[model samples]
Every structure is written in C-alpha cells, then in structure tokens.
Target chain A: MIELHNVSKVYNSGGAPVVALRNVNLTIAEGEFVALMGPSGSGKSTLLTIIGGMNSPTAGRVIVDGIDVYSLSPERQADFRYEYVGFVFQQLQLLPYLTALENVLLALAIAPTPRTEKIARAYEILAQVGLKGKEHRLPSQLSGGEQGRVAVARALVNRAPILLADEPTGNLDRATGMQVLELLRDLNGAGQTVVMVTHDPQAAACARRVVHILDGQIVGDTVPAPEHALAPAVLPISQPAIEPCSNATERVQ
Target chain B: MVLLVVGLAIGVATAVALMAITEAMQADVAVKMDEYGANILVVPKANDLALSYGGITVGSAAYDVATLSMPDVERIGTIKNAANISVVAPKLLGAVPLMGRPVLLAGVRFADELRLKRWWRVEQGMEPSEAADALAGARLAQSLAIQPGDEVEVNGRRFRVVGVLAENGSQDDDILFVDLSAAQLALDKPDAVSLVEVAALCTACPVEEMVEQISHVLPQARVTALRQAVTLRMETVGQLGRFAVAVSAVVIAIGALVVLTTMLGAVAERRQEIGLFRALGFRQRHVGRIILTEAALVSAAGGALGYLAGMGAAVTLAPRVANVTARVPWDPVLAAAAVGCALVVGVLASLYPAAQAARVDPTVALRSS
Candidate 1:
C-alpha cells in the first residue's frame, strides 16, 4: 500500500523554481492496477517518482507500506525502494553487457539470496515472461514488444508488491502497447499493485481504475470501462495503425 | 608527464646508489695496489687452485715485501700479461724506536725502483731512480719523526733519510724505500728475498682466466690480479639495478591501469543509457563481461608499451652513471615487461567499477534522469 498527503515538490532549476507537484493526497491499496493519465507537465511522472522514492518531495510526506519515506535516512530510503518498489519507464532500461537471464539476475545482486539460486530464479522469471527460449539473447536482438516484455519481467522479478511505471506504452504503437498493458494486467492479477502512467485512454482503459492528472493536481479518478478487456493478444509494434482505435484524443502543444 | 618524472627520478637515484659504491671498491683496489706493483704473484709453486686475495703462498702461506734483486725481477717480468716488472726490495717492516713505541718501518729500493714508474702515485718524495736518497711514506715519516736530511739508525748503520714515498696508502704509509743492497744487508739476508712484484696490463680477461695464463708464464712465482677484488662488487650493483628497473616497470603498469579504470568509471556512471540495456535484458557483463574485459586488455597493452619506453630510458641513461658502461642487462627488462603485461594491468583495470555497474538497479535505472 502507498499513500501521499498534501505533497508539494519543487525543482530548484537555479533560475525560476519549477513547481512539479503540489497539495497532492493519494492512496493506493494493495493489489490495485491503477493508471495515471496527464498531459506533459501535469506531474503524473513526478508524482510517481516521488512515490517510488526516486525524488524527494519538497513539502508534505509520502508513505510506502506504512513506512514514512522521508523519516528514513537517505540510504535506508534507497534500501526501501530496492526492497519494496519496482519501477518501469517509457524507455526500457537494461544492461547491454548482460544477457536476458543475467539482466534479471542483476535485480537480485543486493537481494538476500545465494548466488547460484539467484541465477536459477532469474531463469524462472524469464520463462514466466514468455521468454523461455530467449533468456540468453541480447537486448539488441529483441523486438520492441520483446523489450517491453523484458522490462515487465525485470519489474516483477524482485516480487515487490508495488510496481511504478512511467509512460509504459508511450513509445509503442497501439498493438505493442496493448500487449504491454496485458502483461501489466497479468502481473496485477497475480496480486501486484501496478501504478502505470500513460496519455492514452485505451491504454488507461485496461486498468481497473483510472486517475487523471492535470496542472500538477489530480482532476478526477473513476472506475474504467469494463469493455476495454479486448483480447489479450500478442500486439505487434509493427502495426501502429491500432493507436488511433485506442487513445487518439490526447495532445499537448 | 608525472610518471616519466617519477620514473626518471627513481632511475637516477638507482644509478647513483650503484655507481658510487662500485667506483669506491675499484678505487680502493687501485690505491692499495699502487703501494706494491704486484698485479701477479708467484711463490715456490703450489696447486693450480687460485689464491684468495693476492700473492704466492709457500705451502699455504703469506709474505709481505717491497723489493727483489735483478735476477728474480728479470725472471718474473717474462710472464705473458706481465707488461713491466720491478725488483721489490724487501723492507723488513719493523717499528722505528720512539718515546712510546717503535713505529713500523718498510725498507724499499731507492735505486732501480723506477722500472715500474707507471704504477707509483708520488705525493712528496724523490723518484725511485734516486740512489743515495731514501723516501719514507709521508704518513710514516710523520709518525716516525723522520724526514729528508733526518738521520735514523737501522741495524747500527747510521743513514740519512733522503726520500719519503708518496702517500698512495696501504703498504706505502708505514714503509721506507732505500737501496736494494742496503735493505738486503740490513735485514741480514744477502741473497734470500721476501718477494717480487710484477705489474701487468688488463688483457681484457677475467681474473680466473688470467690466473692460468699468469701461472704458465711464472711457474716458480705467484700471480695476483687486482681487478678481481672489485668484480663481485660490480656484479652485486648490477643485480640491484636490475631490481630497480623491475620495480619501476611495475609502478608504470599501475598508472596505466588507473587510467583505464577511470575511463571505465565514466562508462558505468551513465545510468540512462545502461537502463536501456536493462530493459533490453542484454546482460552484457554476464556475456563474459565484454566491455569491462576490453578495458583490462587495453590497459595491458598500454603497460607493455610503457615498459618498453621505460627500459629505453634506462638504457639511454645507464652510461650516465660515473664510470658505468652501458650494458642492457636484458634479463631484467624482459621480466619487468612480463609483469607489466600479465600481472599489473590485467587484474586491476576492470574489477572495481565493473562490479559497480553490475550492481546498478535496472528498475530504478530506467527511471533515472
């Protein structure tokens, strides 16, 4: 579970201060698959960053799993993020020097597990991500959809209860985006709390709940439409024509 | 620039340490041998085994003398390496009578001593060609209260002290030079002599090789090579220079590895790009640690090149040491290069920062700015 109370974050840009988030109160229960939606500078990603302990809030407090994030020391906050929070980004971040299996194992380097068993568990998670035969493949060899799957797998590998993703499907076309949304749902169904941000309503529609953010504040949150369950298909990024059928309305500038 | 400065400083220090002591040992031999021109010795023939320091031994014995008669000097002068010879007049070196104790007196030949004039370094005395003048070693003359025109009684024969031998040190310090006939008569031995001296050229041969050559030429006399006394000291200093070269090579290798590691650090700390790797699940470090592994290989190559350059500097500067000839001493350079290539650079370049990259949190890394 995660909660934020009256949170305000300002970035000291050394010129005029940029207010990233302000007066935010939010609560995410256990096993919730929630989507956060906003245009650029609406603080969707900033909110997620603060909740995941990546950036500190300039005012107010954040609580993850009942532990006050700011109350803990900086190192302990990092430790808390490591043990409890798993993050994904619009750009999948992987170690180019490590193979698929070894990439997953890296999430476990600081985890409390013996090394031999850590390696074996990494293989198991890759198989769970439907990459059984691609465990040793380099990331460069994988397609965009496969890369997103790898990111999802890495986020789920440490078995953190809360998964935070920023712009998870922004770079993907609708097909691949839908496929990635299904994977997030699959993890959510398995009792993981996934907080994902996207501009697409169709992508957000896949979530059980949708939170819309604008002007550094939460505008509205509602239960998503049930019809959005379209088939959990293996969406291909090669077919980006599917984007318009999803969230074609969102635009900034 | 820092490495070259430090390495050259160490090299100069090593050269000074090695050259100073080796020169001193050689100079000591020259000073001691100048007192007696016995470059080779021959005594009532012993075994073919070489003597320890110098001179002939009758059945493992040692004797000291200053001059010999003409026949013995003539016989010994025919030796191969023996370029010149002198009839050393045996000065029965006994103490002169004084207030507290008798002083050491050495009887030398004032006449016919100029035959080996090249060997003597005169400080304050008439040359050996003077017959009526007897020169005491300067220090010996001071100790004995005797100088030129000073009268001294030896064996109840009153003689004027006419000459004092230059202070070349060792035997000359306490010895007196006079006529050969006068010394032999005062010592009570008309025909028997204490020893003879033969001065020889270097011949560019080691002492052991020259010993047999000298023995062949003087079957009944003893031969001593003064150069061998410093030969072992030179070998010791050569070994020390080799060790210094090895240490410098290792230090240079460490510097190269440090630079390689710093570059690797720049690569590891760029989290945004590495996040792309994590999302792709490339796991590059697991694929035999290729990027980091290349760092070590590059550093190893640098170390080899640096070692070559350092050795070039050592060779160029070896002759700069006073009296030290330029000898490459190939064994040390080869060993130091091997260490620079295999041991120093290979292990240190990739280990630490690569481990840091390995521990980067892929999940948080993707979200990092």
Candidate 2:
C-alpha cells in the first residue's frame, strides 16, 4: 500500500512563495488503478510526482510498502523507486538519440540481469506493447501514438509493482487515447497498481476509483462504475482507421 | 567533445615539440663546443713584457720564469674526475730563423693536439707523425713557397714538411707545428712545456671543479677555464629552453581552461538527461564516472595524435627555425608522461561540472521541460 500523510509543496518563484500543494492526504491500495482529476494548477501532477518519489513534498510523510519513503537517503529513495515504481510522462520523454527498443532497455540499466536476458526481456516488453516490428525506429521516426506505446513499454519493462503515469493519453486523439486507456486497464486488471493523473472523464471512467483535487487538497474520492472494458477491437497504432468503441463518459476536446 | 580534444591536442603537441627542440639545441651546442677546442687553458706563472727601444720591441722581458714539467702533466691525469679529461696536450713555443726570416714555431703532441682541435684540416698531407716532420700553417707555407716533402731550415736544422694546414683564420694559421720533443730540443729547452691545453669534458661536471683539481696538482702554473666559450653556449641554450617551457605552460593553461568551460556548458545543457539518469537509480559516483570516462577517452586520443604531430613539427620545422637538426626522440616514457598529463588536466577540469551534473535535482529538472 502507498500512503501519504498531510503532503504539502511550496515553490518560491522570483521572490514570492507559491503553494502548489497544501495538506493533501490520500492512500492507494495494492493492485488498484486510481485516477487523480483536477483543473490546471490544481497540484494533481505534483501529488503524482510526490508519490512517485520524483519530487519531495515540503511537509509530508510518504510510506511505500510500509517503508517511509522520505526517511531514506536520496540514493536509497532512487533505488526504491527503481525497484518498485515506474513513471510515464505526457511528453513521451523518450531520448531522441535512442531507438524504440533502446529506450525500453534503458529502464534495465541498473537491473542486475544478464545482458542477453535484458535484451530478450526488452524485446518481449516491446512486443507486448504492440511495437513488435518497430523496435529499431528512432523516436522521431515513430508516430505520436507509437511514441506513447514506447513510453508505456519503458514504464512496464522493469515490471515495477507501481506505475505512475501523469497525463498518459493527454496528447493522443480520442481513438488512440482510448486504446492507451484500454491498455492501462488491462495492466491494472492483471494486478499492477497504477496511479494516473488526467482531466478527461473518459480516462478516469476506465480507472477503478477517482480522486478529485482542487487548490492542492483532495476534495472528493469515489469508486466509479465499471462501465469501460478492454475493447475487442485490434487497436494497433498502424491501423488508425479502426476506431475502438468509446466509453460512456468520453468527452470531446 | 571535439573542441576539448583539439585544445588538449594543441597543448600536448606544443609541449612535446618544445621538448624535442630543446634536446636538439643542447646536442647542437655540445657539438659546437667540441669543435671550438678545449675549454681549459694552462700557462706558466710568468708575465712576458716586450722591452721597447724607440717604440720598437727589441727583446722580451719576463718578471718570473716558470714552466710545467712532464710530471706536472702526469699529475693532471689524477684529478677527481679524471675520466672527464678528454684531451691533454702540452706545447713548447720558440722563434727560430727560417729562410732568413724569424718565424714562430710550436711543439705539440701530434695525437693529443689533433684530438683537441677536431676542426683542423690538412689541405695537402697528413698530420705530423714523426719527430723530424713538420706541418706548416696556410699563411706560413704560402709565405715560404713550401710544398709537401720539402725541407724547412729552422735554426740551421732542417725538418720535412709533411702537410700544410688549411686556413683556420686564427693564430694556428701563422705558426708551424712540430713534434713536442723536436721543438723542445731545437729551442734548447729540455722537458719544459710553455703551456698545456687541457680539454676537461664538462658535459656533466662542474667546470670549476675540474679547474680546481688541475690547480691543486700544478699550483706553480695558472689554470683557467675558457669562461667566455662556456658562458656563451650555456646562455644561448638555457635561455631557449626556458622560453620553450614558458610558452608550453601558456598553451597548456589555455587548453585546460577551454576544457573546463566546454564541460561546464555541456553539463548545464544536459540537466534533464542527468536528472533522468538519477531518476533511473544511478548514484552520484556513477554519474561522475560517466563524465570522467568520456574525458579520459578523449584525452588519450588527443595525446596520441599530439605526439605524432609534435614529432612531425620537430622534424620539419626545427631545422629552419632553430638551425639545429631535430632528432626525433622515440621515447616511450616521454610519450606516456605527456598523455598522463593530458588525462590529469582533462579529468581535473571536468570534476566540478560532473559534480554539478550529479547534483541536479530530479524534480526540478524533470519539470523544467
């Protein structure tokens, strides 16, 4: 279980202090897929980063798997994150110089696995993400949705128990975004705890629970209806014309 | 990375070239000194003054008469650094009437004098090898209209002219050289030498120490080192070496400064990348190792190329610029030292930048983009 106790973040820009999060407290259970929903400047992304150990809260206690995450040294925290958590950003932060398969292999840089096994594992994860034949393509050569799949492959390559994705489908079209959402739902159904931050209700509708935040504090939390299921449509990014069935709460942007 | 490597290469090349040229200059100077003859001059402890009658020299007046004996020459061989004594030749001088004209004659140990004056050339015949044989200077031979195999009458005694020396443009061009014993017998001075020409090899010795030793053995004679010759060569070669060192230091400093600035800029530009690495579980040392390894690799390549370039510059430019044959020294130790120095400079200059990269805050850096 991941737990947060009175998490707060303050940023000093220029000279004035800006509060990004204020006394935001939340907990996530194991094997749970939760979506954090908020408007802009609502600290939803900050909350996700704090949980992922990417950012340190100004004042809070973060406990991961019963171990106090913030109490350990920065080095140990990095090790903990590598061992237990993986991250996917909206920007598709794949290194431009590396190929798709190389980007996925980057997650195993510190993994104590044999070189041949790591290569095989990276290939296997890429194939699972529906990027089977495009492993050698650079990020610039891949389409937007293919790049997103590469990012997903990198996050899942290490097989970390927790996946923190901030705006995973924010840059994709409705059909492509739905495919990504269905992929996340399938992973969550397979027992990977995933915490995602999104503004689209259709993406949140796919999660098991939704937490609402405003002005750096959680205002609402509820379990949503299981209205979205894995689409039977073969939503390969290469066949963009084959649109998958949409969720009930799909919002047009 | 290219800029860093080029800068380091320039520094290493300049340093190695300077070293090669300095070595060449020292070698050339040694050869020049050898050609200039012995560095130490020995003479009897007496002052000779020409007595004049009506502004014309009538006779010679000496305050004291002292001479170096053959035993004194043998004692000179027992100096502290006896092995450094390369040449020891004693001379007996006198004026004798030859062809009704008074000409000065010098008696020298043929072999020792030949070794001392390595630059001397006999234009006609070989060096004087027998007691009765004489070698005439160019001017003296020309004045007498002499030829090899002819006999020169000196003091009613005749000596065979074996060879005529080429014009050296010095006092040697105006005198005649004969066997030491023959000259001493002709001049009526038995077992007496006017002066000793001692060439003390000072390649690794203190010149004054050799002089002092010679003086201790022959206190009756005045021993003097040819300070003018020694000082002239030392000043020229030492000044050139010091200048080379100063220029090399400046070049190396510029190289190091360029490396530091380039590395700092690279780290600053790669903040997000470094933060990502940290986020991926790389510790501070691991990040530092990455940067240092890159620097060491570039520096080693620069060192090797610079060594070849330096040798090329030395062989092609030293002769024209320094007027010395630049012998390219194939020294592995020097090459290794140059490369090691470049590595040290490159890695040391990158330390602060690597540390700054390691200290990048993952949260801020990740959010910046």
- Say which candidate scores most in DockQ: 2
Q: DockQ score for model 2, please?
A: 0.39
List, residue by residue over B3-104, the lDDT tens digit for candidate 1. 422333343333333333343334433443443344444444444332221223332223332233346545555555444332333322333453345544
In model 2, residue pairs whose N, Cα or C atoms come closer than 3 Å (at least 3 residues apart or on different chains), thus clashing, are none
Can you tell me the CAPRI class of model 2? Answer: acceptable
Q: Which ten residues in a row have the lowest lDDT in candidate 2 chain A?
A: A231-240
Model 2 over residues B1-369: C-alpha lDDT tens digits? 888788888889988888888878887777667555777777766666343211212223256566787888888899998888888988877778888888888889999989888879999988888889999999999998988999987766679999999998877877888998888888887898877888876656677888998999899887888868678787888998899889887887887888889888888887877877776666777778888888889888888878778878887878898898636566787689778888888888889988988788766434637
Instruction: Tell me the tens digit of each residue's lDDT in model 2 across A1-253.
Output: 9999999999898999999999987888898888888787899998988898868899989999998888889888888878878888777678999999998898898788998999999999888878888999999998777788888888888898998888888888877777677777777878989999988766776777778788988877755543432211212112112122355243221
lDDT per model, in order?
A: 0.59, 0.80
RMSD of candidate 1 to the true fold?
A: 14.5
Q: What is the TM-score of each candidate against the true structure?
A: 0.53, 0.80
The top-ranked prediction according to TM-score is: 2
